[model samples]
Target: MYIDSHVHTSFSGDSDTPPEKQIEQAISLGMPVLYITDHQDFDCPPGVPEFTFETEPYFRKLRELKEQFRDRIELRIGVELGLQTNIPTDLTAYASGHPFDFIIGSTHVCCGMDPYYPEFYENRPEEEAYRSYFEYELENIKAYDCFDVAGHLDYVVRYGPNKNTFYSYEKYKELFDEILKTLIAKGKGIECNTAGFKAGLNHPHPTEEILKRYRELGGEILTLGSDAHQTVHLAYHFSAIGDLLKSCGFRYYTVFKDRKPEFLPL
Candidate 1:
């Protein structure tokens, strides 16, 4: 009954695992549902030229996998779009034309810098980077209404030079509150990405404190994902997260179909 809502295949520049291999891995790992959300960041970095979207080929392979594994596991086709506040119109148009089961809007870039590179935070203080990252995320979430969920609410922490030593939602309460408020107002859910645990962080990307605050702020929709790049990582740590969500006052997890959310009791 586990559903891994975020995954990337070889189609994404960062991953080399093919579509079939992704499916085989899912099956071997006993995942009942998997969503292939390859990166569709149009503003490719200098060294990352192949990060563009290949919708046709990606969807074609997805259609094939859906039929081929219809009985064994549920295959959901999805896209993870890097949200830039400046190009909201283009992002909206591109996402509108697709028939994806789920869409995860992410903030991979901030102030023209990709934090994935160590140099992005070389001379900058962790606080400054975190502040800018939250600022960009707030703007992107407010600008784009096409996505179903916001991916990895605190993804910037993973690559920051200081790591998690200096970052926490409590330190950025004002910005964090605004982000949660905007998402609540827009009816967009925040994803609980367990990938942070895999990266050696003590908690998920957005800590349980943020999840509690999100729930307290009247935010209802919350989705879960491992942000798995490999098959063995699918639904990783979800059992613990399910309990965590309940303690945080969320009784349900969400799923999307035709861009609408369906709530499942936790």
Candidate 2:
């Protein structure tokens, strides 16, 4: 059974896919498990309202889908929390009250800028930008303890301006190793986001070498996601990832329920 651990619906603010459409897409794709991890970044910049869990209609819709589709597919109510090290109280309060099946902690901001726009990296040195992004991610990972998994370990590389520039684990060995070690120490899984390939990067987020190193460091818990924003992107190229994971020594891909992880053989 295929499981898509990260996806966005209209609740994410940036996506247009409604909850029902997301469910229908999952069903059509033959994905047995779907986690609607609509983005919940609370401190969005000016003109961008924060996506709150308190949004009653969205949560209500999720509840409805969970019940309606329970027999057709295993629906998981999930959230992808955008992490900022400066606001632990806000993060804690937002997460504490939710009854989530999965929680994905992510760092979408780098050096006070969201890198979604091309202008974010306009004149900056690629290495400096990459380094700062990694540092910010590490900070977020350390600050948030309630999440089940760390989403897209090397997401920053996707928009590096200089696409196809190979970034090896050996190049950032110390920092990359620290990330894997921290995730293992904190008992959180790392998501193998396949969207990097769609983003013009040759490697997946965190790369195969990094995954191999993570396994070498005794990191076992791993999850997979397409980071799909559109229906056509669901489970995008996951079969290739299944082979990559097995080659990297990972025997299982994790699924979450009641915020607890369950291992499924690859």
Which candidate wins on TM-score?
1
Q: In candidate 2, which residue pairs clash? A: none
Candidate 1 residues lying further than 4 Å off, grouped into runs, are 87-89
- Clash pairs, candidate 1, are none
lDDT for each candidate structure: 0.85, 0.82
What does the lDDT read for residue 179 in candidate 2? 85
Cα deviation of 109, candidate 1, in Å: 0.8
Which candidate leads in lDDT?
1
TM-score of 2: 0.94
The TM-score values for the models, in the order shown, are 0.95, 0.94
lDDT of 2 by residue, 1-266 (tens): 46999998888877888878888989987888899998888776564455655546667888889899988887888999888876534787777787888889998876667777676677877777778888888888877797888888888788777744856667678888888899999998898998998887866777998889988999988889889888888888887888889999999989999988899999
